[model samples]
Target chain A: MLKSAKRFALTAALALAAGPALGGALGLGSEARPEEVTAWDIDVRPDGQGLPEGGGTVEQGEMLFQERCTACHGEFGEGAGRWPVLAGGYDTLDSDNPVKTIGSYWPHLSTVYDYIRRAMPFGDAQSLTADETYALTAYLLYLNEIVAEDFELTKENFTSIELSNESGFIPDDRPDTPGLSEREPCMTDCKPEVVIRMRARVLDVTPDTEDTSAVTSD
Target chain B: MSTSRKPQGGTTRRGFLSAAGGAALAAGAIRPAVSAGPENLPPNVPGWSRYLGSGVDAYPYGQPSSFESHVVRRNVAWLTASVESSVNFTPLHELDGIITPNGLCFERHHAGIAEVDPSDYRLMINGLVDKPMIFTLDDIKRFPRTNKIFFLECAANSGMEWRGAQLNGCQFTHGMVHCVMYTGVPLKLILEEAGLKTNAKWLMVEGADAAGMNRSVPLDKALDDCMVAFKMNGEALRPEQGYPLRLVVPGWEGNMWIKWLRRIEVGDQPWHTREETSKYTDLLENGKSRRFTWAMDCKSVITSPSPQAPLLHKGHNILSGIAWSGRGTVDRVDVTLDGGRNWRPARIDGPSFDKAVHRFYFEFDWQGESLLLQSRAIDSTGYVQPTKDELRAVRGTNSIYHNNGIQTWHVRGNGEVENVEVS
Candidate 1:
C-alpha cells in the first residue's frame, strides 16, 4: 500500500513537471490556446457544430454573392466557362449529362456553409466573415428554391435546414462493380472477331504533337 | 583530297540539291549516299569523338539530352478554364522503369502552385488531443523517418474516357498518375506524440494553398501507412508538388494526399467538406452518389504503341506499359493484341512494390497489319481490371472520377495509331 502511494506521487510529480494541464505523456507540442483554436477551426458539421454566432438574410446574400461570386459561379449559380455551377440541375443525376450543383446533388447544407466560408471567390480565400458565409448559404438555397427570398439563415436554425438530396448518398459499395472479380482473363479465342465501334481521330479533339519523327521507327 | 570529290560547305550543297540528279535523291525518287561523308563514316573519327567535349560544371544541375526534349508534361488547352486551375499530363509513353522522374511527374493544382518558405512552415496538431502541438519543419525532421514507394493517381485519371475513347494519347488519357520514393515520418508517430483522446476517430487535413484544400481522413487510414513526407525521389519536395511538406496517404486518391500541409485536427466524426461531398463523390447509375470512395481500383494501360508513340518498324517491337492497384501489389498484367479477343500474360518487369507502379513488356514481331491493342491488370486481391462497357453499365456515363476502364489503341496499316473503342 505504501509503495503504490509512492508510485502515484511520482506520477503526479512527472505530470506537474510536464506543465500540461491535460497531462499527456509526450508533452512535445505547445498547448493550443482558445484563440488559436478559434482562428483555425473553421470546419462546420451537419449538426451545426463549429458555427459562430451570426445571421444573414437571403437578400443580403444575393447582393454579396453577386459582388464576390458570379464571375466563375455565374449570376444565378449557372456557372460560366467551365466553372462550377452552384444552382439548378434539380433532377439530372440519372441523365447522361448530370449537372451536379449544390441543390440537386449535395446531401448536406453544412457543406455549402463550410465551403463558402473556407474557400470561395476563387483567388481570395478565408476572407468571408461568419455572417457573410451565412448570407451566401441563404442566397444559394434561395437560388435552389429550397428557401424563400426573404428567408434568413442563422446559427441557431442552421441544423433545421435539411437538403433535398439528404438521403441520396450511399457509402462506397465497390467490388459491387459488376464483372470486377468474376472476369477470367482468357488467353486464346477470347472472342471470334473484333470490330471497332468508334475512333478518336474522327472527333479530331487530340492536339497535334510537335514530334513528327515519331512516324519513323528504327 | 580529290578536287571533284571535295566536300563543299554551302553553295555546292545547294547547287547539288538544285540539280535534277540531286533533286531526285532529295525527293526520295532515287537512293542517296547513306553516309554524309566517307571520312566520318568508317576508320576515320567522327566530329564528336575527334573534338574535346564540354567540360564538367557546364550545368550546375543536370538535364536530359537535348535530343529528348519531346519527353515532357503536356496540358490539353481545351480541358480547363485557365492554366492556374489546370492539370499537366506526364509523358508516360517516353518514361521507362517504375520510378517517375521528379521533374516529369504530372501536376494538378486547384489554385496553382504555392511557393512556401520552409522556415515559415508550421504543422499544427490540434483538437481532441491531450496536447495540441505545433511542429516546425526542423522539428518534423527530428522524428524517426521511413522510406516508402507509392503511386499517387488522381481520382479522375481516366474521367474523360468514361463516355467513349476521347483522348488520343495514353499520356492525356492516364498520365495523371506518378509513383515515387518518399522520405518521411509515420503519421501515427506524430499523432502519438500529440496523444489522441479517446474520442478521436477522424482527422481533417488542410493545405496552405490559396484553395486551402481540406479533406476528412478516417483515423483508420491515418494509423495505417500514411506519412508526413518532406522529400520525394531523394530531393526536397518540388514546389509544384507541395514544397515544405505533404501528407502521403498510400493507396488512396491523390487529392487526399494534402500538399502544402498545414493543419491536422482530430475529431470524433467526419466533416463532410466540399471536396468529399460535391466534387470527388461518384454518381452511380441508380442516381445515388457514393461518398468517401478513396481507393483507386485496379487499372493498367499500354504506354507504347499508343497514339503518340506509334509503331514505327514492323519487326522486333517492344510493347510496354504500367500497371498498379490501390489495395495491393499487381500480381499479373495481361496484354490483348486483337483488342480483348486474345490475352497473353505480359512479362512483369522492375520493382513490384505495394501500391507502386509496376512495369510490364511484351515483345512481338509485327507483320504490318492493323492491330487493336489493350492491357488488363489484376491485383493481388483477385480483382481484374474492368472494360469500358462493364464500368459504364454499372456507374453510367455521368461520373467525373475513378474511370479505370481498359484503354484501347488502334494501330492502322500505315504505322499510325489512334485511340479507339472496340466491341
Candidate 2:
C-alpha cells in the first residue's frame, strides 16, 4: 500500500516537471534560472560585435609571439608539424580539399582573437593577456599578409580587418526553403537507408603501446 | 556435482584462469554466506571499504576513484596515421552500472582536445536572431537546470568491425560508447535569451577544438530537450569531456554535442560546414550519402561473458550488460545464449530514464560447455532491436554510423571468450 502511494506521488511530480501539456516537441524540460548561468562562449559574429577590449602593434606582437608561441607555432605563424598552420591558405576553400587557415577561411577576426586568448602555446592555455592576444593577432595577420608590417591591432581597427572566407558560410535551407509546406516528422514510419547485421572484419586488435618515455602520468 | 551447469554447460574466463582457486574458495577456505542471517557477513578486503570512496566537500567537481587507475580511455597508437589522427576506446569491459565515470568516457578527436577557459569565453547567438546576445558560461548555468543520463557515442564506434573479426576484445569493438549524467541549463533558455527571431529556425553549434568541428542542428530539436551542459557526473566536466561547457544533444551522435562549444549561430537554415559536407554523412551502396542523420537507434550488448572480459565463477553466475535508446526508455532486454534461438526476458534494474542507460541482469548456472551469448533491446517506442542481417538490409555495408544490432559473444569450454559473429 505504501509503495503504491509513493509511486502515485512520484508520478504526479514527474508529470508536472515535464512542463505544460501540449507544446514540447519531445516533452523535454526547460530551465528555471535561465539567466544566472552565463555560457562564456567567445563567438563573435561577422558584424564585429562581442570583440574584447585590447590593443597591440604588429612589432610588439612579434616579440610576444616569438617568446611564447614560436616553439610550437614556428618563428612566424607557420605552426608545428602537428599543430595547425596559422598564417597562409588565403584562397583554398574552393579546392577539392582546402587547407583552411586564419586569414583565408575564418569568417570572423574575433574568432582569431578569441581562439588565441583561450588556447594557444600548445600546453599552456589562456596564458596570454588581452594586449598580448591583440599583438599576436596582428602579427598573425602580418604573416598571412592580411595586415602591413607596421599595422597596430586596436579595438578601433579590429572591425576593419575582414577575413577571406567570411562569405563561405551558407545556412542550411533544406526543406525550410521559402515555399515549403508541412512535412512529415520522424515520429513513425521512418525509413532508413542501411541496416547493420553482425560485425565482421576487424581492423586492429589494439596492440599494447610501449611508452619508453619517462612520461609523467596524472 | 558443480554449480557450473544449472542452465548448464557455460564456463567463464576467470574460472578457466585458475581452476584450482575455484576449488580452494569453494572449499572451507570460503566463509560461505547463507540465504539469510549472520553467515552472510564476510571480512572486507584490506584497504577497501564497503563503498568505493567518500566524495569530498560538495563535489563542485568530482572524478573517478583513484583506485580505478586502469580504467581509462586508451588509444591505439597505430589505429590511424599518428596519435593525432587516431581514436581512443573507453574500457567498457571493466565498468559496471549505467553511468560511465567521466574519466573513462571515450574521446575521438580529428585534431586534439582544445582547452577553453570559462572567463575569456563568450558564446554569440547571432545570424538570424532578432536580438543577438553573447553569453558567458555563467549566463548558461543561471537558467533553470535539468539532469538526465545519456549515452554519447562516436559514430565511428565499431566502424572497424565492417571487415571481419579483427579486434579480439569487446572493449575495442564496443568501447566507443559511454553514458553519463549531465548538469546544466536547457538550450531553450539560451535561445529565448538570445531572442530567436521569428525566421530563426536552425542552429549551427561549433566546437573550439583545433578543427573547430561544427554541425547544423535543427531548431525544433534544439528547443526540445537539448542542454548546454557544464558538469558531468556531479562535477565540472573533465577536460577530455568538453571542460568549461558542451552541448548535450541527448540520443544524438557525439560529434553534434560539440566539445568546447563556442557558438550557436541561429539561422533561417543549416550551415553546410566542412564537418557536414565531407564527413559524418554515410555513403550508400547506391552512390548517395545519407545526410542530416540524427537519432541513434536502440542497441544492447552482453558486455561481460565476452572477449577481454570473460566469465570467472564456474557456479551460479549472473550475466549483466547495458541497454539503451536514443529515442525513448528501454522497455525490455532479451538475452540469447544460443545465438537468438530461445530468447529469455532479462531482468531490468536501476533508474529508467529516457535516452539513458538501462542495466539488465540474468542469473543462470553454467556447465562446462561452449556457448554463444547475445542481447537484444526493445525501446519504449516499440522499436525492436533488429538482427545484423536486418540492419544490413537497409543500411548497407558502405555505411559506418548507427550500427545498432545484436552483438554475439562466444564462450568456449575452456572458459575463454572470443568475439564472434553469428550469421
Candidate 3:
C-alpha cells in the first residue's frame, strides 16, 4: 500500500508539473469553459420532477400519431413491415410467442407515458406539445385496449392510470444472507476441494458472423 | 457488375476497430511512417490520420476509420425473427487504446432497435412520488450532471460457456462487454425534482421499443449515481445505441439501462416482471432461481495473443488483456502459462477508471513451446476469477449471463492458436 501511495504521488507530481505545457499545447480546446455543456437528459422522476409545465390531451395525441407513427406502428398500433407489434400482448408472458407490448407487458403506466413523450413520433420529434404528448399516451393505451377511447390522459389524471405488468418486476436481492441462507459461505480456509481450468472449447465464435441489423439506437 | 463491386463513392462507415495487427504495429513500416523532416515526405499521411477533418467535423458526430469498412455491429442471421431482433458483438480483436469507438460497440436486444427522436423525448415520474412530474429532454439537461467511463457487460456475456468451449479467442468468449465515456444528468437530480414520497423505494424504468422492456431499479442506487444519458464518447448516441437517450446504470447488468428511455415510476417495491422473473434470472441445479442478480461480478479476459491474434513476433511477446469489476477497479491480474501450475503478476497499464476497462500487460520470452495461456484478475474487493468447473459447480450447466470464469488459450510452436481448456 505504501509503495502504491508513493507511485501515485509521483504520478500526481509529474502531472502537475506538465499541466502547463499540456495546457499550452491544447490552448483553445482547454481554456475558458463553464459547466454548461448541456446535459439535456430530460429524465423525469416519480415525484413530478423535471416535468415541463405544458399539458396535452388524448385527442391531440391521436393526430400526432396518425401523422408520424402510422407508418411503422400501423393505424391501430399493430405494427408494420418487420416492426414490433405494440398493442394487445396482455397475459401472454408464458406463451411460445409472447406478445410483449405496452398494454399487456409494460409494468407501469408512467413508463408508457414517459416513453411516448420522450421517444415517440419516431423520426420526427419535438413536434408534439405537452398536451399532445398526453393525448398520444392515451391513444396508445386505448389502442392496447387498456383504456376506453374516451379516457383522458393529462397531468390531472395521469397518476390514476395503472399497468397490467406492474406486479411482475422485483427488486434485486442477491447480496443478502437471508436470500442466500440455503447456500453456505465458507468461513475458515475456503480453498477449493477441486479446481477446473477454462477449456478453449467453452469459447463461442458464432457471434463473429452474427448480423446486427436490429440493434436499437442507443 | 458483381455484388462486391461498387461505385467507390465515400461509404459512411460506423465504428473502426483497427485490427490488433494495426495497433502501432508498423509504426511507420506497413503504414506510411511519420517523416522526421516536415518536407522530407510528400505530405505523407497515415491510415486513420490521412483524412484531416477539423474538430468541428467531429463536433456533431464522429465516424470510424475509413480503412475499417468491414468492422460493424451484426446479428446472427439464424438467431432471431429478423435482422432487427438479433444481437452482435463488438470487434474485440480489432480495437485498440481501450476506448471502444462508439460506432463499433456490440449490441444485444430482445426486440429491434427503437428509433427515438430527441425533440419529443419526455420522462414521466409518478407512483410513490409526492408530485409526479413530466420532463422534456430540455428539462432533463437542466440538472447537475457528471461523466464516467464504464464497462457495460451483458449477464449473458459468456452464456455460451453453458454448453462447452466453442470459441477460440477472448473476442468470442467475452466480446459482449464495452467500456465508454458517458455524459448525462444524474438520476438523483431527477428523483429530487420529483420529491420521492417516504415510501418510495424503487423506480421501474421502461423502454419505448415495441417490446416495451422494463426493469425495476433500487432507489438507493438510483439516487446515488444513475444517469439519464444522451451522449456517448462525445457525440449524440447512434440509432442502434438507444439513439438520443438511454439510462446509464454503472456497475450493473446492461439490461437495466432502458434504451429509448420513456418513464420512471417510483414505487414501494420491485415489479417482478417477465424479464426479471423469467428471462434474465439464472436457474441453478436446484429448482430455485437466482433472481434479481443485478451486479456483473469481477471478470477478466486476455485480449491479445489468442487465436485471432496469432504469434507474429516469436520471442519477447507482450500479452495484453482487460479486467474490470462492477464493484470497483481491478486491483491486480495474474497470468499463467501451464494452467494454474505457475502464475506471475501482470503489469496494469493506463488509468484504472472506476467500473471501467483496465488493461494489463505481461512481457515473457518463449522458445516456441506448446503452452496453455490463462489470466485471472482480482478486484479491489478481493473477488478472484473463478475456474470454469468452479463456476459450473455452483450455477450448473443450464445457465447464461454473468459467466466470468478464468479463460485459457492454447498456443502451438507454429504460431497458431485454438480453443483448449486446461484442467
Report the number of the highest-lDDT candidate. 1
* Model 1 Cα lDDT, one tens digit per residue, A117-138: 7777778888888999999999
Winning candidate number (TM-score): 1
Candidates, ranked, TM-score: 1, 3, 2
Which pairs of residues have clashing backbones in candidate 1?
none
Top-DockQ structure, candidate number: 1
Distance from true position, residue A11, model 3, in Å?
30
Tens-place lDDT digits, model 1, residues B266-338: 9889999888999899998878999999999889999998888888887889999999999999999999889
Error of 1 at B108 (Å): 0.9
Mark the regions of model 3 whose C-alpha exceeds 4 Å error after superposition. Answer: A1-218, B1-62
Candidate 3 chain A weakest lDDT stretch, 10 residues: A25-34
lDDT (10s digit) by residue, model 3, range A145-172: 7777777776766766777765654444
lDDT of 2 by residue, B1-423 (tens): 122221211265333423433343334222212112332246533222232323345244444432233356777664664464457887787778889977778887755776788787766665665455666777666666778788888776777665445576667778889999999977876676555667777887877776566777998888777998999989898887778888999988888998888777776666545445345655444434456667777778877776666666576778888888888899888886766556788999999988988899998887756677888888876777776566566556655666676788777676667676765
Better of 1 and 2 by DockQ: 1
- Cα shift from native, residue B351, model 2 (Å): 0.8
Clashes of 1: 0
TM-score on alpha carbons, each prediction: 0.89, 0.62, 0.63
